[model samples]
Target: MLSSLALLSVVLPSALAATTYDMVKEYSGSTFFNDWNFYGQFDNLTNGDAIFVTSSVASSSKLAYVDSTTNRAIIKVDNTSTVAFNDKRNTVRISSKDEFDIGSVWIADMYHVPFGCSVWPAFWSQAPNWPSGGEIDTFEHWNLELHNQMTLHTEPGCTQASPVQTATVVNSTDCSFQDNSNAGCGVMDSTDSSYGAKFAAAQGGVFVTEMAESGISVWFFPRSSVPASLSSNASSFSTADLGTPTANWPTAGCAIDTYFKAQNLIFDITLCGDAAGAASVFQQTCSGVCYTDYVVGNGSVYDNAYFDVASVRVYSVTGMNTIVRVSSALGFRAGCWVWGAAALSGAVVLFAL
Candidate 1:
């Protein structure tokens, strides 16, 4: 009886805790565009001076394509054509066809990210219902800021808890969209190589985000610092390997499972929009107004505005049993593994029988 009780204490916890993560979807190479839905419209959300082109326009104009030389995907703005002072330049906005819920991990391997004066680029995830479903900005920054900002925007109640384990600095703790002028709960990366010209110069990096029941964590690994298990061909991953994250939003104050759900990954670049066009924000990076100096140009200023992506992969968590069947040492039924307290009581009855 003593031996059986000791075994139960050790094995029961493993049975409930063991989990495996599997790659459910991958967007990469030539087939990357097939899984995305292009947003062919104006920048209505931010009121930016950008025309999100249709798939046909994107292909015909070469705004989005796979680079033949590097075999990587490239989504870029129109740098060749001249735009009239009143017109908006052509750009691309796309969202994944698939939707992911919590208990998932997203990894993006990149060679470059869009950046320039008046350029607002973001790689993020959001649900269809806006703040109700929640929004997670994995990579976002504009103008001359050389650091990535990770943020979460939800309904009125969500906020970051104290002493969140992260390497980045917290910008705002309030995640409520209605509050803080829509700043959300933001954490800025400390490394200068986190965004823009500096990021591209160091050959780019990777952004990993895990949305779990406990909370949300984001990590930025530069080209030289990426883990070996996170390669493009990796079919599985263990979150335990990723050390202290760049930003962590614990569930002590915010219930992640209630706020975040059914999210679709998105990438878009809008020029001279709300965030980048604000007078106070625009003047910090470049001279002259955003619309007049940058958006209305001959497209020469946006030469560096593009995303050279290697791949974006999503992994879903699946529960699995890791405990081996007991050798009938405690008179347990064959192939019957106990779960909770009820199951454990039944096992004891079977042992007596």
Candidate 2:
């Protein structure tokens, strides 16, 4: 009787504590962008709650445009010229006016970012560099995917490879790399589709990042399976509501909490050659070229580089636990080892019965 009771206790709690998350926000039309704050100076465009542009020439270039079907805004990039790093030349800033206290877990529904030769598009964050403020690149595709990278640019040692602590995904050799300590850390989702287009598909998906007192976890969910409530705030969801866990949680060598806990969010779409050290990759002949010539020749290549954000929401865990529960039910079945163990344990019980 005692043994049976103990077994019931374990199994019941495990079943009741199923992993679930809430849907904080969702967007599905051209009207969503109306309330966002837009920055950067370019002319010749349409302005409304639906579309925005810096220059009509830039807009026509294809690097910047809007999509009505997927209801996504794209930021395309062309390697022909170096517009990414120029602080003054090309920049687009879009952020939410509402400032919510971001807890450890958050997600972004982004459609795509640039991934061509010599192109750089980043979905990152920043705070004043005081107690040493820094940057976290959630999705960074640089130099033709040779080294799809994510890093923390902070007081030395705060990079992706040197996370202060470590964590791992279940049953896999794949690992998350925290290149620097204070700078930032990230994992690579090496699917063939770019981050932007993947989120914008008809099945629009979810990009989730959870920063717990214990660590951080990030995962993506396709639109078809995403909960309807999470698709829009028409209803509210708590973490406890996320039915079963998905095996996609980060379970490798770096601590997710170390990089994502208690941070503010920033959304900006920058042209090529804007960051500090991204110019050398440009073709030699393309140097000293003006935006007009580049657009005329092959410049308009990046014209569609845009990030359509359906919604951004933050959640608080309110506890200090280190282990993040992930479910293998979504395509990721429990491995052979776990199944074998369960069978052996059950056999032992049957003999006793």
Candidate 3:
């Protein structure tokens, strides 16, 4: 059955509500809709899921769009037709116009989140540099998982043991190359409603990520629970006022300022990648054949694969280059976009994954 979510009430601390943070960047409505640069293509060979099409092709295929309903950005996976096992599924992947560094807070207002079988959608942040710049997976939803995942990827010398908040479930503490690849130090939000169907049922809401001198933290507010100050009308939004975070990554064992730098916000939907496709359940559904076979055969399974984002706004303390006015359709490309080139062309790549 299709699920829809409602708003959750959030009680703001009296002391925090009085304060305010400057609203630096706001990506809402149609004015800034076209400012996004369309990615022609990107290949995640290490995961070995499927090939992605360019933005133009994605728009043509109804996988991506921006209009009245999608003025904020609506991206989805191939659900309109029966796909061939060999044929790649259509999807949408996009990045913000500008690069954001530490001490920035991002709030994503979503109406629908990606869910369903063989689906892996992520809204993460990363720098142009690979492991050096670091990556933070704010919300990575996999059909196989029951909770929301928050991970940080960086070079060697980062651990989640000390300084890490115990509110969430810590998987691996190491943010370095655990197995020649940055598996990342990650934690899971045990709240069932924090992701997927539960989140969708709540009508989706806000995802707040704040990177400060202390560490990185994430908060998810369902539509019913969004902070009053952050709703349609309020002076401004601030991290101090939001109370405690759902996921917090302190710097006792890690130097967040060192690893995490200027990064672009990203959103993408991938099918049968290294994580989802490699699972036994993923293979079991496809008649003992390949994961792609199941995904191709059960095309209707992806009918709910879509992202109806209402808003993506960024706030800053200093208010540095806050808003990103839309430039060309393909404004500026991030170096990280070419993450795996040689590996795709059949050659040795510096960063394995």
Q: Model 1 misses residue 75 by how many Å?
A: 0.7
Model with the higher TM-score, candidate 1 or 3: 1
lDDT of each: 0.74, 0.36, 0.63
Per-residue lDDT over 1-353 for candidate 2, one digit per residue giving the tens place of the 0 to 100 score: 11111121011112222234443433335544443444434311111111123335335654444576655655443324443322223434443333222344456665444433333455544332222333344555532442223334333333222222111211111122222112123333433343434444443466555544333334445666666655664333455444432312231333443433334344444333322113333332135332333323444554444555555555444442222221222111111000111121121110000
Instruction: Please give each candidate's TM-score.
Output: 0.84, 0.51, 0.80
Higher-lDDT candidate of 1 and 3: 1
Q: How would you encode candidate 1's per-residue C-alpha lDDT over 105-198 as one tens digit per residue?
A: 8899998999989998989887766767788989987887777878898888888875244443555677877654565776767788989998
Clashes (N, CA, C under 3 Å) per candidate:
0, 72, 10
Runs of candidate 2 with Cα error greater than 4 angstroms are: 1-31, 34-36, 41-91, 102-104, 128-134, 146-183, 194-204, 222-262, 274-299, 313-353
Q: For model 3, what is the error of residue 17's alpha carbon versus the real structure, in angstroms, after optimal superposition?
A: 14
Which numbered prediction scores highest in TM-score against the true structure? 1
Model 1, TM vs. native = 0.84
Please give the lDDT score at residue 2 for candidate 3.
Answer: 9
